[model samples]
Target: MLTLNQIKNNPEELIKKLSVRNKDFSQLIHDAIKTDNKRKEIQSSLDATLEQSNKIAKSIGQLFKEGKQAEAGKAKSEAAELKEKAKELTAKLNDAKAELQTILFEIPNIPHPSVPAGKTDADNAEIRAGGTIPKLSKKVPHWELADTYDLIDFELGNKITGAGFPVYKGKGAKLQRALIAFFLDEADKAGFTEIMPPLVINEASGFGTGQLPDKEGQMYQVTEDKLFLIPTAEVPVTNLYRDVILKEDDFPIKMTAYSSCFRREAGSYGKDVRGLNRLHQFDKVEIVQIQHPDKSYETLDEMVAYVESLVQKLELPYRIVRLCGGDLGFTSALTYDFEVYSAGQDKWLEVSSVSNFETFQANRLKLRFKKVGEKQTQPAHTLNGSALALPRIVAALLENNYTEEGIKIPEVLQKFTNFDLIN
Candidate 1:
């Protein structure tokens, strides 16, 4: 949520800045300001009524002590009237405050100044490209490769469960485990503490990460238990510090976790739903950070470089793109998406996204920190990124490294996979 000062002091400037999102929040901003103003006005009136009531009660006591029964009765009556008015003002204040919060919740984080103006992925600016697209005269899609090798059993998975839940068998299962291990080891080497977070989260946890009520439809909810299946490890990992306060020395805190992400893929369509392109259940290694606001952007860049390293180690042809305003996540101030090229599909599949939420999630989480000699605390900045989502990375690996021999495992992952090729 934006600070109230931002809305009241510069709604016009805020509107102009967020125009890149292609939606106007001018009326919402104005309504929030108006609601806040009414809340303040009612609050002031209540304060005055309470103060006067206190003074009148004191006067009644004085009169009673002096045996002035008549005067005491009159002051008591006035105090009763003031108390009634205070009650009405108190109720008005609550309504106004709640109304303002409703409006604030509907607004998304303002984009950073560097964010480009655009409407969709086509508008995203490519930052840089790396690796080389292989020269493949013929390459089959990952689904075909899986079937030919008896690796993943989509039909079996359907018999047991449903679509989007492919069952891995033999080498396919081993490769998935190997990829998870590889990603975890890389994160561990990058100075992040490994965490094993729960797959199910409560409503509070969902809301803390801006998942509830915004992207609610995209999550699998365990309705009877009021728990939501985590869409990403980011939810549980980042909530580790929810409602927590840290000392100045804890400036940079990092955590990494591997989780089986569950998404409804609510309305995924057409070519987008092919094979591993979109899945209800997929594995991902996530990295999260809680940093001092001043150093968050630096941490964001560091995270970007770390993800870049993972893609390079895998030897996949990839590119980094800066997300345009419209494509940015709800809580992120700035985001960069990393796409790996899949030769079989002849498309760029997004395998990771690194973002700096810059206190947006922290504000909702109530995660705060105290400065060295300061008595007051301020919200810490939060950031998270997919170190790499396994499915698409696996897609690119199988597609790009395919040959008559078999799929070639990346040299870095050979030790984990226990073989050079999967035939």
Candidate 2:
């Protein structure tokens, strides 16, 4: 929800930037401007009618005081007509504003200048890569390792829920807990205040994070309660500051939360949908930050560095890629995806995505920060990233660390997992 002022100031520039997403935004921009104009006109009519009606009421009082009952009655009738017109104008104004908002809702955020002009993930530019690709003699995939070592059960998950819901057993469940704890501890060490957000959120919470109306189909909804299962901890954690005004000193506000994320992931299939690769329910540790606009990009770099460090600590071979326009998330201006080399799958699996949504999500959330001596509050830049998501990270760890004895746990996670191997 871009502000009216933003749209009025060179909206064409915004539309042109969206060309990288490969869509035409001309008609949407036109409809928004037209609807705004109609709203302004209706608002003017309402104001004029209200003013005229007030004047007539004053005239009616004067006429009555001067012993002219017929004249007062005429004034009252005129006031009634004006009141009806004002009501009609008010309704029109509401309708017009609604129309304008509907159009705005359909428009995605404009990409940052650095966003590469591309159509898919394959077009994304690689930033940097780290660690050595393991040369394992056994080319066993993660699912096979899961079965051989009693880590996860897909059939039991299918029996209880359906496909795409995996049941982690024994050390498998312990590994999930360990990764969540490890990620949380790492984020907490990085000056992020930990928060435990709700698993179910209302429509406003979803929309505040740009998950509603657009991604409604990809979420599990509780129809009776009118709540949606949070697709990520990002939704609830970020929405906590919705409609809040922060002081200038709160520039680098950092918070982290670990939550069980749920996603419908409707219509996804193929070789990519196997095991922990894609899931209806998964665990994740999310980091969110609200920063001053002037320093947001710097903060984004710090977040990316922090996630990179975590991946390094896990001793996983990883690469960083700047998401191209088409592959970018709807609300993010820029995003860097961290993918771990899964030797088992013989491919890189995305374990984290760090993004900077400068003013785009803030406008929707009404989140603003007031300058020390300024009267007006300005929208602050919002940022978030998966310090690490468990499923794929778990997949990569198991696959890359496989040994004849058992799946060897990384030394960093051994303390958390309470054992070195998952046999």
Candidate 3:
């Protein structure tokens, strides 16, 4: 949520920047300003009326004390009328403020100046790519390799729960666990405190993370309990600082968590749901940061580099792309997506996304920090990234590392998996 002052002071400039994200603001901005102006007018009127009423009441009391009964009665009548006017104006002020807030919530954050104006992922700029694509002796899709090795049971998972929820067996399950631990370990080494947040969150938590009002359909809602299954550890981990006011020393709070993410993947149909491409439930290790506004962009770059290192250590062929305006997430001002090469599919599969949300979420969450030696509270910048998501990474690994004998595990993960190969 943008501050009314920001909108009022530079409406045109802000709207122009937001246009890069294809947001139209002519009407919404104007309406919000009008509502805010009305609210101020009503408040001023109410304040003046209340002040006059208080003065009249004071005069009435003095008159009564001085034995001027008639004068006191007249003053009392005037005060009553002033009080009634104040009440009416107060109601109008409340309504106007509510209208203003509604409009403000509808407006999105302005895109960062560096964001490219484009319509789709195809228009995204490739900033950097790392590692090398492996040469394959035989093309084998991840799902086929999983079956040949009896590692993952998709059919049984479908009968037990539903599609998009495969059951990992033997080496498959071990590899998944290894990835989670490896990612978390890397994040910890990078100054992120490891956290284990709740998998279920309330409505307020969802809105705090900017998941409600727009992506509600993409979450699993527990209607009876009024809770929603977390779509990512980001929701709960980032919400940890919601409504908090911290000292300057707490400017950049880094945290990471490993959680089983749940999503409805609604409207996704056909073969796109095949194998590990899309899933209703999957594991991910997430990294979140609450930083001072000035240092947020730097933190974002560092996070991207960190995730890139992890991907490179796994020896997976991957590339980093800067998301174009239209392809950016709603809460993020800037984003970089990491896509790993899948040999069998002969395409890049998105395995993680690192984004800088700036103060967009902090405003909604009321997450603030007191400036050094100052009494004012300022919103902190919030950022989150998937250190890595397991499903697609698993898919990429299986397809890219498949051999005639078995699938060779990455050297970094050998210690964690207790084996050099999954045969």
Root-mean-square deviation (CA) per prediction = 2.2, 1.7, 2.3
TM-score of each: 0.94, 0.96, 0.93
Order of models, best lDDT first: 2, 1, 3
Per-structure clash totals for the candidates: 0, 0, 0
Kindly report which residue stretches of model 3 are placed more than 4 angstroms away from their true locations once superposed. 50-83
The total of clashing pairs for model 2 equals 0
Candidate 2 wrong stretches, greater than 4 Å:
55-72
- The better-scoring model by lDDT among 2 and 3 is 2
> Which candidate has the highest TM-score of all?
2
Q: Model 3: per-residue lDDT, tens digit, 37-86? A: 88888988888898999889888889988999999988888888988898
Clash pairs, model 1 backbone: none
For model 2, residues 65-159, the per-residue Cα lDDT tens digits are 99999988888888888888888888888888888888889887878899998989999999999999898988789999999888899999999
Instruction: Give me candidate 1's TM-score against the actual structure.
Output: 0.94
